[model samples]
Target: MSFKYIDVIKELINKIENSQLDVMEKVAQLCAETIIRGNILYFFGTGHSHMISEEPFYRAGGFVPVYPILETSLMLHDGAYKSTLMERVNGLSKILLEQSGATKDDIIFIISNSGRNNVTVEMAIEAKEKGLKVIAITSLIHSKSVKSRHPSGKKLYEIADYVIDNCGVVGDAAVQYENFEQKTGPTSTIAGVLIVNSVISRAVEIILDKGWKPPIFMSSNTDEGDEFNKKILQKYKSRIKLL
Candidate 1:
Protein backbone atom coordinates (compact mmCIF):
# COMPACT_ATOMS: atom_id res chain seq x y z
CA MET A 1 0.00 0.00 0.00
CA SER A 2 2.82 2.34 0.89
CA PHE A 3 4.37 1.87 -2.55
CA LYS A 4 1.29 1.49 -4.65
CA TYR A 5 1.82 4.72 -6.57
CA ILE A 6 5.41 3.79 -7.31
CA ASP A 7 4.26 0.44 -8.56
CA VAL A 8 1.67 2.13 -10.70
CA ILE A 9 4.29 4.42 -12.27
CA LYS A 10 6.55 1.45 -12.98
CA GLU A 11 3.73 -0.30 -14.76
CA LEU A 12 3.10 2.79 -16.84
CA ILE A 13 6.77 2.88 -17.89
CA ASN A 14 6.68 -0.79 -18.82
CA LYS A 15 3.63 -0.20 -20.96
CA ILE A 16 5.38 2.57 -22.84
CA GLU A 17 8.63 0.65 -23.18
CA ASN A 18 7.08 -2.55 -24.44
CA SER A 19 4.60 -3.23 -27.26
CA GLN A 20 4.02 0.49 -28.07
CA LEU A 21 6.92 0.91 -30.49
CA ASP A 22 4.96 -0.01 -33.62
CA VAL A 23 2.18 2.45 -32.93
CA MET A 24 4.60 5.17 -31.88
CA GLU A 25 6.65 4.77 -35.06
CA LYS A 26 3.53 4.79 -37.20
CA VAL A 27 2.27 7.97 -35.54
CA ALA A 28 5.66 9.55 -36.02
CA GLN A 29 5.69 8.61 -39.66
CA LEU A 30 2.38 10.29 -40.27
CA CYS A 31 3.45 13.39 -38.36
CA ALA A 32 6.72 13.55 -40.24
CA GLU A 33 4.96 13.20 -43.54
CA THR A 34 2.61 16.01 -42.62
CA ILE A 35 5.45 18.31 -41.65
CA ILE A 36 7.55 17.38 -44.65
CA ARG A 37 4.62 18.31 -46.85
CA GLY A 38 4.12 21.61 -44.97
CA ASN A 39 0.71 20.60 -43.66
CA ILE A 40 -0.58 21.30 -40.14
CA LEU A 41 -1.12 18.82 -37.30
CA TYR A 42 -3.93 19.70 -34.92
CA PHE A 43 -4.70 18.27 -31.50
CA PHE A 44 -7.92 18.36 -29.48
CA GLY A 45 -9.20 16.97 -26.21
CA THR A 46 -11.69 17.72 -23.40
CA GLY A 47 -11.34 17.76 -19.59
CA HIS A 48 -8.15 16.26 -18.19
CA SER A 49 -7.37 14.92 -21.65
CA HIS A 50 -6.79 18.49 -22.83
CA MET A 51 -3.38 18.40 -21.23
CA ILE A 52 -2.17 16.01 -23.91
CA SER A 53 -3.13 18.42 -26.69
CA GLU A 54 -1.32 21.16 -24.82
CA GLU A 55 1.89 19.11 -24.82
CA PRO A 56 3.20 19.81 -28.36
CA PHE A 57 2.09 23.37 -28.96
CA TYR A 58 4.80 26.03 -29.21
CA ARG A 59 6.73 24.63 -26.29
CA ALA A 60 10.49 24.23 -25.92
CA GLY A 61 11.75 21.48 -28.19
CA GLY A 62 8.29 21.27 -29.76
CA PHE A 63 7.25 21.71 -33.39
CA VAL A 64 5.67 24.83 -34.84
CA PRO A 65 3.36 22.94 -37.22
CA VAL A 66 1.59 21.26 -34.31
CA TYR A 67 -1.47 23.27 -33.25
CA PRO A 68 -3.81 22.80 -30.29
CA ILE A 69 -7.52 23.61 -30.38
CA LEU A 70 -8.12 25.36 -27.09
CA GLU A 71 -11.87 25.82 -26.74
CA THR A 72 -12.47 27.50 -23.40
CA SER A 73 -15.87 25.93 -22.85
CA LEU A 74 -14.33 22.47 -22.81
CA MET A 75 -11.48 23.40 -20.49
CA LEU A 76 -11.54 23.29 -16.69
CA HIS A 77 -11.80 26.90 -15.67
CA ASP A 78 -14.38 29.31 -14.24
CA GLY A 79 -16.96 26.51 -14.06
CA ALA A 80 -15.68 22.97 -14.35
CA TYR A 81 -19.20 21.61 -14.39
CA LYS A 82 -19.99 23.82 -17.34
CA SER A 83 -16.96 22.44 -19.12
CA THR A 84 -18.17 18.92 -18.39
CA LEU A 85 -21.60 19.70 -19.77
CA MET A 86 -20.16 21.32 -22.89
CA GLU A 87 -18.03 18.28 -23.58
CA ARG A 88 -21.17 16.18 -23.97
CA VAL A 89 -23.00 18.79 -26.03
CA ASN A 90 -23.39 17.50 -29.58
CA GLY A 91 -22.61 19.61 -32.69
CA LEU A 92 -20.28 21.94 -30.76
CA SER A 93 -17.16 20.40 -32.27
CA LYS A 94 -18.33 21.09 -35.80
CA ILE A 95 -18.27 24.81 -35.16
CA LEU A 96 -14.77 24.60 -33.71
CA LEU A 97 -13.41 22.28 -36.40
CA GLU A 98 -14.66 24.49 -39.22
CA GLN A 99 -12.33 27.32 -38.20
CA SER A 100 -9.25 25.24 -37.37
CA GLY A 101 -7.69 25.39 -40.88
CA ALA A 102 -7.21 21.63 -41.02
CA THR A 103 -6.95 20.41 -44.61
CA LYS A 104 -6.89 17.04 -46.32
CA ASP A 105 -3.10 16.90 -46.05
CA ASP A 106 -3.19 17.69 -42.34
CA ILE A 107 -3.72 15.39 -39.37
CA ILE A 108 -5.97 15.78 -36.32
CA PHE A 109 -5.41 14.06 -33.04
CA ILE A 110 -8.30 13.64 -30.58
CA ILE A 111 -7.64 12.33 -27.10
CA SER A 112 -10.02 10.72 -24.62
CA ASN A 113 -8.77 8.27 -22.08
CA SER A 114 -12.09 6.50 -21.86
CA GLY A 115 -12.56 6.92 -25.65
CA ARG A 116 -16.20 7.64 -24.81
CA ASN A 117 -16.96 11.34 -25.06
CA ASN A 118 -19.24 13.29 -27.38
CA VAL A 119 -16.86 16.19 -28.08
CA THR A 120 -13.81 14.15 -29.02
CA VAL A 121 -15.84 11.76 -31.12
CA GLU A 122 -17.61 14.56 -32.97
CA MET A 123 -14.34 16.37 -33.56
CA ALA A 124 -12.77 13.27 -35.11
CA ILE A 125 -15.82 12.70 -37.28
CA GLU A 126 -15.82 16.30 -38.47
CA ALA A 127 -12.11 16.16 -39.14
CA LYS A 128 -12.48 13.00 -41.17
CA GLU A 129 -15.42 14.49 -43.03
CA LYS A 130 -13.13 17.36 -43.97
CA GLY A 131 -10.71 14.74 -45.42
CA LEU A 132 -8.15 15.11 -42.63
CA LYS A 133 -6.57 12.06 -41.03
CA VAL A 134 -7.55 11.38 -37.42
CA ILE A 135 -5.37 9.91 -34.70
CA ALA A 136 -6.61 8.93 -31.25
CA ILE A 137 -4.81 8.66 -27.94
CA THR A 138 -6.89 6.62 -25.53
CA SER A 139 -6.93 3.64 -23.23
CA LEU A 140 -8.50 0.67 -25.01
CA ILE A 141 -8.75 -1.16 -21.71
CA HIS A 142 -10.81 1.69 -20.34
CA SER A 143 -12.89 2.12 -23.52
CA LYS A 144 -13.83 -1.55 -23.62
CA SER A 145 -14.82 -1.40 -19.97
CA VAL A 146 -17.29 1.48 -20.39
CA LYS A 147 -19.99 2.50 -22.87
CA SER A 148 -19.44 5.43 -25.25
CA ARG A 149 -21.48 8.56 -24.61
CA HIS A 150 -21.83 9.34 -28.30
CA PRO A 151 -25.20 8.63 -29.95
CA SER A 152 -23.42 6.66 -32.67
CA GLY A 153 -22.29 4.20 -30.02
CA LYS A 154 -18.71 4.49 -31.32
CA LYS A 155 -15.54 5.45 -29.50
CA LEU A 156 -12.70 7.74 -30.57
CA TYR A 157 -10.46 4.78 -31.45
CA GLU A 158 -13.17 3.41 -33.69
CA ILE A 159 -13.20 6.62 -35.75
CA ALA A 160 -9.51 7.45 -35.87
CA ASP A 161 -7.13 6.41 -38.62
CA TYR A 162 -4.59 5.58 -35.92
CA VAL A 163 -5.03 4.63 -32.28
CA ILE A 164 -2.47 4.83 -29.47
CA ASP A 165 -3.51 3.41 -26.16
CA ASN A 166 -2.40 5.14 -22.99
CA CYS A 167 -2.71 1.77 -21.24
CA GLY A 168 -4.24 3.41 -18.18
CA VAL A 169 -6.87 1.71 -16.10
CA VAL A 170 -10.48 2.74 -16.10
CA GLY A 171 -11.26 6.07 -14.39
CA ASP A 172 -7.53 6.91 -14.98
CA ALA A 173 -6.60 6.10 -11.38
CA ALA A 174 -4.10 3.34 -10.63
CA VAL A 175 -3.04 3.54 -7.01
CA GLN A 176 -4.88 1.46 -4.45
CA TYR A 177 -4.37 1.69 -0.74
CA GLU A 178 -5.38 -0.70 2.00
CA ASN A 179 -8.85 0.02 3.40
CA PHE A 180 -9.37 2.90 0.95
CA GLU A 181 -12.11 3.04 -1.66
CA GLN A 182 -10.55 5.65 -3.93
CA LYS A 183 -7.33 5.46 -5.88
CA THR A 184 -4.89 8.36 -5.61
CA GLY A 185 -2.66 8.32 -8.69
CA PRO A 186 -4.23 9.30 -11.99
CA THR A 187 -1.80 7.80 -14.52
CA SER A 188 -3.39 9.12 -17.70
CA THR A 189 -1.62 12.49 -17.60
CA ILE A 190 1.78 10.88 -17.21
CA ALA A 191 1.08 8.19 -19.75
CA GLY A 192 -0.44 10.68 -22.16
CA VAL A 193 2.53 13.02 -21.90
CA LEU A 194 4.94 10.19 -22.50
CA ILE A 195 3.03 9.05 -25.56
CA VAL A 196 2.77 12.59 -26.93
CA ASN A 197 6.44 13.49 -26.47
CA SER A 198 7.75 10.16 -27.64
CA VAL A 199 5.76 10.34 -30.85
CA ILE A 200 6.85 13.92 -31.52
CA SER A 201 10.48 13.09 -30.82
CA ARG A 202 10.32 10.17 -33.17
CA ALA A 203 8.87 12.44 -35.80
CA VAL A 204 11.75 14.85 -35.31
CA GLU A 205 14.23 12.06 -35.71
CA ILE A 206 12.63 10.98 -38.96
CA ILE A 207 12.76 14.53 -40.25
CA LEU A 208 16.44 14.75 -39.35
CA ASP A 209 17.17 11.60 -41.29
CA LYS A 210 15.99 13.38 -44.42
CA GLY A 211 18.35 16.36 -43.83
CA TRP A 212 15.47 18.77 -43.64
CA LYS A 213 15.57 21.12 -40.68
CA PRO A 214 12.42 20.73 -38.59
CA PRO A 215 11.23 23.91 -36.89
CA ILE A 216 11.81 22.96 -33.29
CA PHE A 217 11.38 25.63 -30.63
CA MET A 218 14.15 26.36 -28.21
CA SER A 219 13.98 27.82 -24.70
CA SER A 220 13.67 31.61 -24.69
CA ASN A 221 16.28 32.03 -21.98
CA THR A 222 19.15 31.10 -24.29
CA ASP A 223 21.04 33.85 -26.15
CA GLU A 224 19.81 33.10 -29.70
CA GLY A 225 16.87 30.92 -28.76
CA ASP A 226 14.39 33.80 -28.83
CA GLU A 227 15.59 34.91 -32.25
CA PHE A 228 15.53 31.36 -33.53
CA ASN A 229 11.99 30.68 -32.29
CA LYS A 230 10.77 34.17 -33.24
CA LYS A 231 10.91 33.39 -36.98
CA ILE A 232 8.95 30.16 -36.56
CA LEU A 233 6.52 31.88 -34.21
CA GLN A 234 5.85 34.71 -36.64
CA LYS A 235 5.31 32.28 -39.50
CA TYR A 236 2.79 30.20 -37.55
CA LYS A 237 1.14 32.87 -35.36
CA SER A 238 -1.30 33.73 -38.10
CA ARG A 239 -1.97 30.14 -39.14
CA ILE A 240 -2.49 28.67 -35.68
CA LYS A 241 -5.44 30.09 -33.76
CA LEU A 242 -3.77 29.99 -30.33
CA LEU A 243 -0.22 31.07 -30.95
Candidate 2:
Protein backbone atom coordinates (compact mmCIF):
# COMPACT_ATOMS: atom_id res chain seq x y z
CA MET A 1 0.00 0.00 0.00
CA SER A 2 1.03 3.59 -0.53
CA PHE A 3 2.29 5.76 2.30
CA LYS A 4 -0.94 7.74 2.27
CA TYR A 5 -3.00 4.60 2.79
CA ILE A 6 -0.62 3.39 5.46
CA ASP A 7 -0.92 6.75 7.18
CA VAL A 8 -4.69 6.45 7.10
CA ILE A 9 -4.54 3.01 8.68
CA LYS A 10 -2.24 4.22 11.44
CA GLU A 11 -4.53 7.12 12.18
CA LEU A 12 -7.58 4.90 12.39
CA ILE A 13 -5.80 2.34 14.57
CA ASN A 14 -4.72 5.13 16.89
CA LYS A 15 -8.23 6.52 17.00
CA ILE A 16 -9.68 3.16 17.96
CA GLU A 17 -7.04 2.45 20.60
CA ASN A 18 -7.22 6.01 21.94
CA SER A 19 -11.02 6.05 21.98
CA GLN A 20 -12.99 5.83 25.22
CA LEU A 21 -12.32 2.44 26.77
CA ASP A 22 -15.12 3.19 29.20
CA VAL A 23 -17.63 3.24 26.35
CA MET A 24 -16.34 -0.07 24.97
CA GLU A 25 -16.63 -1.71 28.36
CA LYS A 26 -20.15 -0.45 28.78
CA VAL A 27 -21.18 -1.70 25.36
CA ALA A 28 -19.66 -5.11 26.02
CA GLN A 29 -21.44 -5.35 29.33
CA LEU A 30 -24.78 -4.61 27.73
CA CYS A 31 -24.34 -7.18 24.96
CA ALA A 32 -22.98 -9.83 27.30
CA GLU A 33 -25.82 -9.46 29.75
CA THR A 34 -28.42 -9.52 27.03
CA ILE A 35 -27.02 -12.63 25.36
CA ILE A 36 -26.64 -14.54 28.61
CA ARG A 37 -30.28 -13.79 29.33
CA GLY A 38 -31.40 -15.53 26.09
CA ASN A 39 -32.03 -12.62 23.80
CA ILE A 40 -31.29 -12.90 20.06
CA LEU A 41 -28.75 -10.64 18.32
CA TYR A 42 -29.48 -9.37 14.80
CA PHE A 43 -26.61 -7.78 12.85
CA PHE A 44 -27.62 -5.38 10.07
CA GLY A 45 -25.51 -3.67 7.44
CA THR A 46 -26.63 -2.52 3.98
CA GLY A 47 -23.51 -1.80 1.94
CA HIS A 48 -19.82 -2.21 2.65
CA SER A 49 -20.43 -2.55 6.35
CA HIS A 50 -22.08 -5.89 5.58
CA MET A 51 -18.65 -7.35 6.14
CA ILE A 52 -19.19 -6.65 9.82
CA SER A 53 -21.91 -9.27 9.92
CA GLU A 54 -19.77 -11.99 8.33
CA GLU A 55 -17.61 -12.83 11.34
CA PRO A 56 -20.37 -13.28 13.91
CA PHE A 57 -22.42 -15.34 11.50
CA TYR A 58 -20.57 -18.50 10.44
CA ARG A 59 -17.02 -18.33 11.79
CA ALA A 60 -15.54 -20.37 14.58
CA GLY A 61 -14.68 -18.62 17.89
CA GLY A 62 -17.85 -16.52 17.46
CA PHE A 63 -21.10 -16.52 19.35
CA VAL A 64 -23.60 -19.13 18.16
CA PRO A 65 -26.90 -17.34 17.82
CA VAL A 66 -26.15 -14.27 15.76
CA TYR A 67 -28.22 -13.36 12.66
CA PRO A 68 -27.05 -11.34 9.66
CA ILE A 69 -29.77 -9.15 8.14
CA LEU A 70 -28.87 -8.46 4.55
CA GLU A 71 -30.67 -7.45 1.37
CA THR A 72 -30.04 -10.86 -0.15
CA SER A 73 -31.53 -14.13 0.90
CA LEU A 74 -29.99 -17.63 0.96
CA MET A 75 -28.98 -17.08 -2.65
CA LEU A 76 -26.53 -14.35 -3.61
CA HIS A 77 -28.62 -13.36 -6.63
CA ASP A 78 -31.61 -11.09 -6.05
CA GLY A 79 -34.87 -13.02 -5.92
CA ALA A 80 -38.53 -12.47 -5.10
CA TYR A 81 -37.81 -11.95 -1.44
CA LYS A 82 -34.71 -9.82 -1.96
CA SER A 83 -34.52 -6.08 -2.45
CA THR A 84 -34.96 -4.79 -5.99
CA LEU A 85 -33.20 -1.48 -5.50
CA MET A 86 -29.94 -2.77 -4.06
CA GLU A 87 -28.55 0.60 -5.04
CA ARG A 88 -30.83 2.38 -2.57
CA VAL A 89 -29.27 1.15 0.65
CA ASN A 90 -31.99 2.34 3.04
CA GLY A 91 -34.95 1.07 1.09
CA LEU A 92 -33.35 -2.33 0.76
CA SER A 93 -33.02 -2.63 4.52
CA LYS A 94 -36.66 -1.74 5.05
CA ILE A 95 -37.81 -4.42 2.66
CA LEU A 96 -35.56 -7.02 4.21
CA LEU A 97 -36.58 -6.29 7.83
CA GLU A 98 -40.26 -6.14 6.98
CA GLN A 99 -39.95 -9.82 6.22
CA SER A 100 -37.61 -10.67 9.12
CA GLY A 101 -38.64 -12.80 12.08
CA ALA A 102 -37.17 -10.51 14.75
CA THR A 103 -39.05 -10.48 18.05
CA LYS A 104 -39.27 -8.18 21.07
CA ASP A 105 -36.65 -10.01 23.12
CA ASP A 106 -33.90 -9.65 20.54
CA ILE A 107 -30.89 -7.36 20.09
CA ILE A 108 -30.05 -5.38 16.96
CA PHE A 109 -26.53 -4.31 15.96
CA ILE A 110 -26.59 -1.67 13.25
CA ILE A 111 -23.21 -1.34 11.50
CA SER A 112 -22.44 1.60 9.28
CA ASN A 113 -19.36 3.69 8.66
CA SER A 114 -21.39 6.86 8.21
CA GLY A 115 -24.27 5.88 10.54
CA ARG A 116 -26.33 8.51 8.73
CA ASN A 117 -27.85 6.19 6.15
CA ASN A 118 -31.60 5.92 5.80
CA VAL A 119 -31.68 2.13 6.23
CA THR A 120 -29.68 1.95 9.46
CA VAL A 121 -31.71 4.65 11.18
CA GLU A 122 -34.95 3.06 10.03
CA MET A 123 -33.96 -0.38 11.33
CA ALA A 124 -32.92 1.12 14.66
CA ILE A 125 -36.28 2.88 15.02
CA GLU A 126 -38.24 -0.20 14.07
CA ALA A 127 -36.19 -2.45 16.30
CA LYS A 128 -36.57 -0.11 19.27
CA GLU A 129 -40.31 0.20 18.69
CA LYS A 130 -40.52 -3.57 18.82
CA GLY A 131 -38.75 -3.53 22.22
CA LEU A 132 -35.41 -4.79 20.95
CA LYS A 133 -32.09 -3.65 22.41
CA VAL A 134 -30.22 -1.57 19.80
CA ILE A 135 -26.43 -1.41 19.55
CA ALA A 136 -24.80 0.78 16.91
CA ILE A 137 -21.32 0.35 15.39
CA THR A 138 -20.40 3.46 13.47
CA SER A 139 -17.91 6.29 13.18
CA LEU A 140 -18.69 9.18 15.54
CA ILE A 141 -17.02 11.85 13.41
CA HIS A 142 -18.64 10.59 10.22
CA SER A 143 -22.14 10.30 11.63
CA LYS A 144 -22.04 13.73 13.22
CA SER A 145 -22.44 15.42 9.87
CA VAL A 146 -24.98 13.11 8.18
CA LYS A 147 -28.56 13.85 9.19
CA SER A 148 -31.22 11.20 9.48
CA ARG A 149 -32.86 10.17 6.24
CA HIS A 150 -36.08 9.55 8.11
CA PRO A 151 -38.67 12.30 8.49
CA SER A 152 -38.53 11.82 12.26
CA GLY A 153 -34.99 13.27 12.09
CA LYS A 154 -33.31 10.63 14.16
CA LYS A 155 -29.88 9.20 13.27
CA LEU A 156 -28.46 5.82 14.30
CA TYR A 157 -26.48 7.44 17.11
CA GLU A 158 -29.60 9.10 18.51
CA ILE A 159 -31.66 5.92 18.45
CA ALA A 160 -29.08 3.36 19.58
CA ASP A 161 -28.98 2.38 23.24
CA TYR A 162 -25.24 1.68 22.89
CA VAL A 163 -22.78 3.06 20.35
CA ILE A 164 -19.42 1.58 19.27
CA ASP A 165 -17.30 3.82 17.13
CA ASN A 166 -15.53 2.15 14.20
CA CYS A 167 -13.13 5.15 14.22
CA GLY A 168 -13.04 5.37 10.40
CA VAL A 169 -13.50 8.63 8.57
CA VAL A 170 -16.99 9.58 7.36
CA GLY A 171 -15.96 9.45 3.74
CA ASP A 172 -14.28 6.07 4.36
CA ALA A 173 -10.65 7.12 3.69
CA ALA A 174 -11.16 7.13 -0.09
CA VAL A 175 -10.21 10.79 -0.28
CA GLN A 176 -6.54 10.17 0.50
CA TYR A 177 -5.79 9.25 -3.11
CA GLU A 178 -5.23 12.08 -5.56
CA ASN A 179 -6.57 9.92 -8.39
CA PHE A 180 -7.79 6.38 -7.53
CA GLU A 181 -10.16 7.15 -4.69
CA GLN A 182 -11.39 4.17 -2.68
CA LYS A 183 -14.40 4.41 -0.39
CA THR A 184 -13.29 2.26 2.54
CA GLY A 185 -10.50 1.95 5.05
CA PRO A 186 -9.44 0.10 8.23
CA THR A 187 -12.41 1.04 10.37
CA SER A 188 -15.67 -0.80 9.66
CA THR A 189 -13.96 -4.12 8.96
CA ILE A 190 -10.92 -3.90 11.24
CA ALA A 191 -12.43 -1.98 14.12
CA GLY A 192 -15.65 -3.88 13.70
CA VAL A 193 -13.84 -7.17 14.21
CA LEU A 194 -11.89 -5.79 17.15
CA ILE A 195 -15.08 -4.57 18.77
CA VAL A 196 -16.72 -7.96 18.40
CA ASN A 197 -13.66 -9.75 19.71
CA SER A 198 -13.49 -7.38 22.66
CA VAL A 199 -17.13 -7.98 23.38
CA ILE A 200 -16.57 -11.72 23.26
CA SER A 201 -13.51 -11.51 25.50
CA ARG A 202 -15.26 -9.37 28.08
CA ALA A 203 -18.29 -11.59 27.93
CA VAL A 204 -16.09 -14.59 28.57
CA GLU A 205 -14.68 -12.80 31.60
CA ILE A 206 -18.15 -12.24 32.95
CA ILE A 207 -19.15 -15.82 32.31
CA LEU A 208 -16.03 -17.10 34.01
CA ASP A 209 -16.62 -14.80 36.96
CA LYS A 210 -19.82 -16.76 37.54
CA GLY A 211 -17.63 -19.87 37.92
CA TRP A 212 -18.57 -21.31 34.53
CA LYS A 213 -16.22 -21.90 31.62
CA PRO A 214 -16.63 -19.54 28.67
CA PRO A 215 -18.30 -21.28 25.72
CA ILE A 216 -15.54 -20.46 23.30
CA PHE A 217 -14.61 -23.06 20.69
CA MET A 218 -11.31 -24.81 20.95
CA SER A 219 -9.50 -25.24 17.66
CA SER A 220 -11.12 -27.99 15.63
CA ASN A 221 -7.70 -29.49 15.26
CA THR A 222 -7.51 -29.91 19.03
CA ASP A 223 -8.72 -32.91 21.02
CA GLU A 224 -11.18 -30.80 23.07
CA GLY A 225 -12.74 -29.24 19.99
CA ASP A 226 -15.94 -31.21 20.01
CA GLU A 227 -16.73 -30.67 23.69
CA PHE A 228 -15.88 -26.98 23.80
CA ASN A 229 -17.80 -26.14 20.63
CA LYS A 230 -20.77 -28.21 21.70
CA LYS A 231 -21.20 -25.97 24.72
CA ILE A 232 -20.67 -22.83 22.67
CA LEU A 233 -23.22 -23.85 20.07
CA GLN A 234 -25.78 -24.97 22.62
CA LYS A 235 -25.60 -21.62 24.35
CA TYR A 236 -25.62 -19.38 21.30
CA LYS A 237 -27.62 -21.47 18.82
CA SER A 238 -30.46 -19.06 18.17
CA ARG A 239 -28.38 -15.91 18.55
CA ILE A 240 -26.05 -16.66 15.63
CA LYS A 241 -26.60 -14.48 12.60
CA LEU A 242 -26.97 -16.08 9.14
CA LEU A 243 -26.15 -14.15 5.99
Best by lDDT: 1
The digit string of per-residue lDDT tens for model 2 on 42-107 reads: 788755577776667645676565678866542235453343234334455556665667778778
Give the per-residue lDDT of model 1 (tens digit) for 78-163. Answer: 47999988989999999998888778889988888987888888998899999998999888999999888999999898999998
Quantify all predictions' global Cα lDDT against the true fold.
0.88, 0.69
Compute the lDDT for candidate 1: 0.88
Q: What is the lDDT of residue 194 in candidate 1?
A: 89
TM-score of each: 0.96, 0.78
Candidate 1, superposed: residue stretches over 4 Å from native = 1-3
Error of 1 at 52 (Å): 1.2
Worst lDDT 10-window in candidate 2? 80-89
* Alpha carbon deviation, residue 179, candidate 2 (Å): 8.0
